[model samples]
Target: MRFVTDPELTPELIDELVDCWTDVSNAGGSVGFVPPVTADDIRATAEAAFARCGDDDHLVAGFDAEGRVACWLILGDAGSWLRAHWRWVLRVMVHPKHQGRGYGSRLMGAADAAARALGVEALHLTVRGGTGTERFYAGLGYVEAGRIPKAIRLAPGDDRDEIYMVKSL
Candidate 1:
């Protein structure tokens, strides 16, 4: 299980990644969007984000033995003077078909190693509170640092807290 980083993602790569993300989102994973997501919707969002990314932002992913992209996470540089020492983990997920094969662990471990290599002392990420995501990160040695109540709204009356987690490298 080797981890690779694509610092400059191409158009084709983004399209492929959007497909992967669509699958994850449609399966009811909290990935910055509601369920029943579409590839076009995610692709447009990705285009906007790519336009704003700094040079150091990158895509960290792991491929399966069949040569398909099984999972990926974004490593954000925090994009600020004070927070430069930290990296933000964004949209980390293993496609539903690839889950429970130890791929998520390898993906997260690689993200941590990459942060350390960049002289980072801490990593940050947010997950929807009141779900199993926080537990998953805790198992990966992350500590719950904070939570904001009713911060994320999935629908009209459906809302969830936003949990902030930290892992010190």
Candidate 2:
């Protein structure tokens, strides 16, 4: 996987990300939107994430051998000088078709390197509980910092805890 940061947010790149996010959500990947989502359903959020790049935030995208986005995530600053030592990792997603290819780990490794390059000391991210996403992050050396119960409501009866994980670099 070849990772690039803050790639040109052209229409083509945004469209590709929307498509990838749609597929990942539909395949049960934890990337904000629920399953059965269309590209249009994810377009606005994807655009907003892109708009966050170029300043204290960055878009780290990993491409496959064919040059398609296999996985991606965002490194976001908290917008305060006091919080400059840490970055929030958001919207981490791996195209379902490429899941078994280990792009998820590689994508995160890229995020780690990117954060280090920016003089960051810690990385924070949240996962919807019951998804077992914490285990994946733990494998990469992230520790559970805290959890907010019933924080994410996918539906009336389908609520999940929001697990906060952090890694000290």
Candidate 3:
């Protein structure tokens, strides 16, 4: 697997991003929104995000043996007022078919390097609390910073807590 900073996210990249999002949601990744999320919604969101990446943001993509995008990790510089010394890991998703192949870690390692290059002091991300995914982030050197109870409403009748984690560069 190889990591590349997506300078311009074309329609093809958007399609691949949607596929990865759908697969993760269906597999209960709890990244956001929820299962049954439409392709149009995913495309619209990704397009907007890609447009924002034009500034001081980095979007890293992972390609598989076939040279197709298999995963993506987004890192955005912290706002000036908030402190430019940090970069927030916005989204990290690996296609279900590509999960367990170390693509996620590869993407994360690339993001960490990108943040360091941008003079960032640390990287931050939020995950769903009480889930096994916390262990994954922990293994990546992200320590729990805090948690917000019932912070995310995934489904009509379901609510999940948010776990904020951070790692120093």
For candidate 1, list the clashing residue pairs, or say none.
none
Please give, for residues 85-161, the per-residue lDDT of candidate 2 as tens digits: 99999999999888887888999999999999999999999999999989999999999999999999999999999
Q: After superposition, how far is residue 127 of candidate 2 from its true place, in Å?
A: 0.3
lDDT of each: 0.83, 0.92, 0.81
Ranking by TM-score: 2, 1, 3
* TM-score preference between candidates 1 and 2, better one: 2
- What does each candidate score in C-alpha RMSD? 1.6, 0.8, 1.6
> Candidate 3: TM-score?
0.91
Q: lDDT by residue for model 1 over 1-169, one digit each (tens)?
A: 5577764567776776788899999998888888887998788887766665546676787877876778988888787878989988998989899998988888999888878877889989999976788998999999999999999998898889999999998
Between candidates 1 and 3, the one scoring higher on lDDT is 1
Q: Which stretches of candidate 1 lie over 4 Å from their true place?
A: 51-54
lDDT digits (tens) for residues 1-169 of candidate 3? 8788754677787787777877787777765656677766577776777777857778888888897878887887677856789988987888888888787888889888888877889999999865778899899999999999988876676777898899998
